[model samples]
Target chain A: DVKVTQSSRYLVKRTGEKVFLECVQDMDHENMFWYRQDPGLGLRLIYFSYDVKMKEKGDIPEGYSVSREKKERFSLILESASTNQTSMYLCASSLIGGDAYEQYFGPGTRLTVT
Target chain B: TQLLEQSPQFLSIQEGENLTVYCNSSSVFSSLQWYRQEPGEGPVLLVTVVTGGEVKKLKRLTFQFGDARKDSSLHITAAQPGDTGLYLCAGGVLMNYGGSQGNLIFGKGTKLSVKP
Candidate 1:
């Protein structure tokens, strides 16, 4: 079975603070993604990485950045956290070819900004 | 932009009832996927339909993709409390830009509650 793990299951941060969410996948998938889910908004993509050092912005990438220094790890960074940034963050990975569309998601991290 | 619209945002029913959720879109999709997310957990892939007018069954759950590949449906038979969750439909599109190989457009989701 494929396993995707996040660095934190729940996190609390103050406004204007920097925040980092880490994700690691055991499967050697080539594509990794970051998404923030909200009520009535569904899962909106934040950023995605196709390979090491390659990053792409998704539909909603404002105030967020990503890092993919290695194939197994992907990180989401918030320059300065705001109350509006509080959300459930999910990380997913998939293989390159025919299976690329079938993403395996990690347990989400619920971030609270106060 | 590709968008998926899910109907009946919320549903509440007693056990042993039958229910169906619909996902509609105006744009064609290369493939469609269904996922179920329990409270406080991430969405899990339930099934994926690639061909048009395809039907796949998993236990008591049945999934169908429309002939035009622009819509899909999920039907649960004799629903149980264990089937309570948020159902999400996503459409896949091949991307030529954005360093990403492909992208998925997700629906707002249908939250279902089955009472025992």
Candidate 2:
């Protein structure tokens, strides 16, 4: 079985604070993604990394950044946390290039910005 | 944006009942995937349909892809309480734009509740 793990299951931050969400996958998949799930909005991609040091912006990338310094870890950073950024964040991993067409997700991290 | 629309946002049914969920899109896709997500957990891949007009079944669950590759459906026979969860449909085209090939664009999802 594939295991995707997130650093924090729950987090609370004050406005204008910096937030970091970490993810690690044991499957060594080359593709990793960060998404935010909201009611009525579904899962919207924030950023994705295909390889170490290579990143791509998804549909929603504002006020967020990503880091993929290693093959197994991907991190999502919130530059200035705000109430609008509070939501359930998910991390996923798949085989290189995503040709496999399926993503294995981690237990989400519910971030609250106050 | 490749949009996937799922209908019947919520469904409540009794055990032994049959139900079907539909996912629609205006654009063609190389494939579509169905996932079931439980509370506090990530979505799990249930099935993937690639060929247009194809039907695949796993145990009591049946999945069908539209002939145009623009839609798909999931049908469960004799639904069980254990099948309760949020069902999401993701559709996307295959491209080589920096590892995004075959990435899934998702639907809002359907919350299904099966009571025994």
Candidate 3:
């Protein structure tokens, strides 16, 4: 079965601290995405990478950044953790072709900033 | 900007009840997809409808795409407690942003609870 694993199920960070969340997919898909899920706003994309060392900002990429050093791993970084940034972070991967929109997602990391 | 609007943000029903969730948009999409996310888990793809006026069925669930390709709906028959989850509808659009080929516009999602 295809599997996407995240580095942490839950995390707590202090305000102004730098935080990192990791995601790894066994499918070796070419597309990776980072999103933050909030109660009323839904899942807002933070950043995405189509290939190694390639990254693109999404609609809500202000407080977040992403890195794809290898094909299997995608990392999400919080430059300065704030209380408003507390949310469930999701990572997803998909193929590179026409059906690349079909994504497989990881369990998600719930981060709390204080 | 493309936006998908989902109706009935929250639904609670008893086991064996029937329900329908609607997703509507003003912008046309190349495809529409349905996903179910259980608590603490990421969304899982349930179905994808590419053709206009297409209807697909999986077990007790049925998904339909509008003839205009701008809306979609998901219906469940005899829903069980296991069916409780957050249902999200996403529309696919071709994108050339930063060389990214495709992107998805997601609705806010409908949270469903089935009481057993």
Error of 3 at B48 (Å): 0.9
Query: Which pairs of residues collide in model 2?
Result: none
Clash list (residue pairs), candidate 1: none
**Candidate 1 chain B lDDT trough over 10 residues, lowest sum:** B95-104
> Largest DockQ belongs to which candidate?
2
DockQ scores of the candidates = 0.63, 0.68, 0.64
Candidate 1 lDDT, tens digit per residue, B1-116? Answer: 78999998999999999999999999999899999999999999999999999999999999999999999999999999999999999998888854436778999999999999
- On a 0 to 100 scale, what is the lDDT of residue A19 in model 1? 98
TM-score of each: 0.98, 0.96, 0.97
Q: Give the alpha carbon lDDT tens digit for every residue of A1-114 in model 1.
A: 889999999999999999999999999999899999999899999999878998999999999999999999999999999999999999999877575388889999999999
Question: How does chain B score by TM in each prediction?
Answer: 0.96, 0.94, 0.96
Q: What's the true lDDT of residue A86 in model 3?
A: 92
The local distance difference test score of each candidate is 0.94, 0.91, 0.92
Evaluate candidate 3 and give its CAPRI docking class based on DockQ.
medium
Sort the candidates on DockQ, descending order.
Answer: 2, 3, 1
Which parts of model 3 are misplaced by more than 4 Å? Answer: B97-100
Tell me the lDDT of model 2 at B99. Answer: 42
Lowest-lDDT window of 10 residues in candidate 2 chain A? A94-103
